[model samples]
Target: MSSLPDGVRSRTVSTDRLETHLLETGRADGDPVVFVHGNASSSRFYAELLADLPDRYRAIAPDLRGYGHSERRPIDATRGLRDFAEDIRALVAEIEIEQPALVGWSTGGGVVMRYAIEQPESVASLALLNPVSPHGYGGTRRDGTPCQPDYAGTGAGMANDDFIERLEAGDRRADSDASPRNVMRSFYLAPETELDPELEDAYVDALLNTETGDDYYPGDATASENWPGVAPGEGGTNNALSPKYLDLTGIVDIDPAVPILWIRGAEDRIISDTSFFDAGYLGKIGELPEWPGEDEYPPQPMVSQTRAVFEEYADAGGEYDELVVEGAGHSPHIEQHDEVLSALTAHLDDATTRIGNS
Candidate 1:
């Protein structure tokens, strides 16, 4: 490799359905840990962090279809968090691992969030970094909104040039208006960050060889359900709180059986599955923490802020723990790699330890 550190030896586990990709290291005999990436990004986000982990962790970070190394198009048009879990299940079956720890970032958090709830057997425990969900999952978001796009109309393809142009334009506009600093809460925001290079290349390869490089999860279905009172934008606006409450409190009810460890950055902006904020969250990578004695100004909870929600969850003793990464923005793994790893290692060890004891 170039001046950048050498990444792990990875492979593509292709089933009859999809070819899963990963950046792996650690001993083969160690407990298998699967890493899931969030929306707008891929497993590539974890490259540096995984590369630096201890050798005892057999980590497998996969690019969810459409985001990373995996083929994107012709995917199940009905793809949802559960569909992602199915992929993880298939991967587990492929490796014949009895129990593997699950780790997800942002949208990937939503995936594992659903997985542990629906199929607890697959994940021994979870580590969610800067996770985004409209509902305060682990004190992330509590308004009971789901962030996704309104794929109701002409969602011809994930990579449809015209559609992509529109999407990119909207994203750029949102970024410009809300400010990249504000949107940093959504995912890793390196002043010079692009899609994971390897996964991006792999996607290009797949796009050239595959039939469809399109997104299966329609924006129409997922976007409308955002921060409780936030309405959909550019995509549409059906964001009235009452209907939103019914959709959240009644529709996709929260399950509390699964254990969660959430790492909140001092500055977190993006709320997952909830399109409450414009792509530009609070006009910064995320919201800054308001301390007790920092500003003479009185502190109040940030409106539609994910950090506030996550803190609330911790107070409720929701089977979860939260950490604040000082100086880290949206993607703590990038901002505080070592600290993030320490937190993850601790949680995973606890998970396998409990599993072994039980």
Candidate 2:
């Protein structure tokens, strides 16, 4: 494993739902800030961020179930990200973390949003970094409507088989388009952006730690009569992110509304309207055969959906800020470290002041 970032410590904590491994930094008495990593990643991704947080803030990043050093527990996709959210709840309780500021990246964004919804009083603030849509990842419209009744063309079936194979095999070499390293470089960051070699290796190492099977990474897929001939099955992480199961639009209605910071890379291909990872978008671009017309299967307007929902939240008396970082991709936190940190810390500070004043 790559060496941990300075001042970061790794430990495992037992929760009611699963055993969670986490990276932590800062003083025990400092204000709590929890960082949740995206899918196909682990807490290790946040080691440097945790190490660099302001001294007055205690930062914690946990490996969700089926990732990192955490227990390999089967995800219950039927509940969407609730299982993941509940795990965070359990961890917060176990660690006695008080009114934590929550930061979630990619799929982890869905996790924290769900957490805030289910446990509205728990979160002090939320930061979403290149997150999935408020409606879910794919198979949805700008108004949060499902394109197909069965939610076909979403979930584990959307995953590239070759990439899954390489991930399961732990192929760290960037020799193929499907290799985890190459995929990360291509889709996870700004095109041609080169990470520090050690951080690159550490990120890949975290990616490799993802548990793969019908019960994990790509999850399970069912045969479909729809364009993709596959639909989400009721198991695994990917399925949990499927719109058929996950609907985080209710976050707008959470009481004691938590302030939000939504950050996205301007060049992010994963969560954009024409997301490269979305099958519907692929069909529109003629990347998939037997193309379904745009009306029947349009590219999900993910960013628009998130914006619409946040607008509703704001109208309902909540507050949020959206940051679009240029020359970056899906993982802006890694690609534009200084800029992201500055925005994040300022947001946290504002939240801290709000809490103190209240």
Candidate 3:
């Protein structure tokens, strides 16, 4: 593993399911806060954030299975976010963390949602940072309905071949459009914002740790009737995030609902209503050719779907707060650090109070 930023220490925790690699900071006996990272990223992404956490909080960021230095466990995509959630559950149990607050970013948000749904009593609070939709990533309508029963235009096939190749080869070239480094700069943060060389290098290193293959990064694919002509296959990272496998809309039914804090970047291109990563949107703009009209296959309303689910959760007695970081992109934590820190600290404080009362 590369050298972590100041105050962040690298460690491995052996859970019943898998041996997990993590970066941790703050006091070991302090309030537990677990940070879950998203796709193509690792715990290293939270190194600075964890290191800067309040002294009273024990912040830990684990590299989910097959990412970073963790064990390369085969992911069962058909299980949706269960594999990741179960690993988190086991890790928390093994570490004896009691009602830890979960902070999930992007895909990690989906995992934490699943964790909360499956084990609500174990969660103190939830902080979703530009999370994927409760209905999953793609192939869904604004009302959270699937564009097709098979969930085409999503999963592994949606991944760009050149991008995956660059990732697999650990390409660090900034010139190539497919390079992970370029992708991070273009989509992870505001395009005009310059990244510190050290931070940029570290971020690229973390991305390079992603395991790429039919059973990992992009996963597998199937034939499709959708414009993309590809559907979600049975297994892998992308498949795991497909709507066919992941759906947390049932969260409204959880008894004793967990408090939630939804933080998003106002300029996030990856999770927006017209996300550039979404095939339907790409097709609509003629980037993918042969778009099957908006009515038949509209772009997945990522943010709207999240709002609807959270609205339902609120109606069911769950409380939540949404904060939009203006001018930020997919990674508001990095782009708007001070704002994110303040929001997270406040949310954690509330979570502590809630847990105390409960």
Candidate 4:
């Protein structure tokens, strides 16, 4: 466990799969709420959120395998997000948590969605904060069909080399735009939002803890005929998230659908309809070269795809709601803390009531 803020304590829980590191708040006897963090970030990212939760609920945020202080386990990208979902399952079992509300942010949201799909009976509720598309992050259309059979335009090939180098070196100097610190400042919040220097530094430290290699962060790549010239190479986090491997749109088929709360920053650029990071969008905007034109290589309709899936889920008798925080970016919980907290608290309460009634 690493040093964390007051009220947020760290501990290790041994699961059948691995020894997981977690940051926890609230009371041991309280209802459980598991928080799953996104890519490149550790459980520490949720420290403030955990501490702010009502005392009746125990807030626990665990560092996913291969990230933060967790064991550096081999990630089988072909399993899609199953590795992460199973890890969460094992953690919940080890902790003896029952019917815990699952909260996921960014890629973490994808993990929770898979969890709900695989173990619908175990989940009490779900909250997705700027989650990746249900069809996966990239290499797909609005309907989740791969643009190419090889799933190009995604995976490790899409990651910026300079950014990876800066992250690996723990580059704190904001001199270069590719520096992790600068990237976080630019993309994690709205431009006008003022960040506390110390908190920002802590968040950057969490990002630096990410393991970078062909087996971890960005994964590996292979040659392709697509405009990007590369495709997912079978393993690592990014590859696991490629449309070739990940897809949760079938969550609408979950026998007993879990209640869901979809909250996101309206101005989020990372997981938006035209994500700034998506190669197709970058190419269309002349930030990248040789886009195959919109018909052949359109920018991924991330938000639209997610909305469509949730719409189907709702039509299938699942309860779902949406909240868009104005002027926020990828991280609404941090940028618009009070509003997110209030909404989450209310959602959790409603979920608890619903579960109790059932």
RMSD for each of the candidates: 9.0, 0.8, 0.9, 1.1
Q: After superposing candidate 2, which stretches have Cα over 4 Å from the reference? A: none
User: How would you encode candidate 4's per-residue C-alpha lDDT over 1-358 as one tens digit per residue?
Assistant: 3456678888889999988999899889888899999998988888888888888998889999899999998788889989999999999988889989999999999999999999888888999999999998886777889877788888988998999999889887889888999888888878877888888888888898998888888898999987789999877999999988898887898877888999999888899888998877887899988888888888899999999999999999997899999978999999999999999999999988888789
Model 1 TM-score, 2 decimals? 0.64
Instruction: Kindly list the per-residue Cα lDDT of model 3 for residues 1-358, writing each as its tens digit.
Output: 6677788888898987999998888898999999999999999888888878898999989999999999998889999989999999898889888989999999999999999998888889999999999999988998888887788898898999999988888898898877899999989998767878988998999999999888888898989765679999877889999998998888887777988999999999998898998988998888888888898789999999999989999998998899999979999998988899999999999899877786
lDDT of each model, Cα atoms only?
Answer: 0.51, 0.91, 0.90, 0.89
State in Å the error of residue 191, model 1: 7.9
Strongest candidate by lDDT: 2
Residue ranges of candidate 1 with Cα displaced over 4 Å: 1-4, 74-79, 134-187, 190-258, 272-276, 279-318
lDDT of 4: 0.89
Candidate 3 versus the native: TM-score? 0.98
What pairs collide in candidate 2?
Answer: none
Query: Which structure is stronger by lDDT: 1 or 3?
Result: 3
Report the error of model 4 at residue 141, Å.
1.6
Q: Each model's TM-score?
A: 0.64, 0.99, 0.98, 0.98
Ranking by TM-score: 2, 3, 4, 1
Q: Which stretches of candidate 4 lie over 4 Å from their true place?
A: 1-3
lDDT of 2: 0.91
**lDDT at 51, model 4:** 81
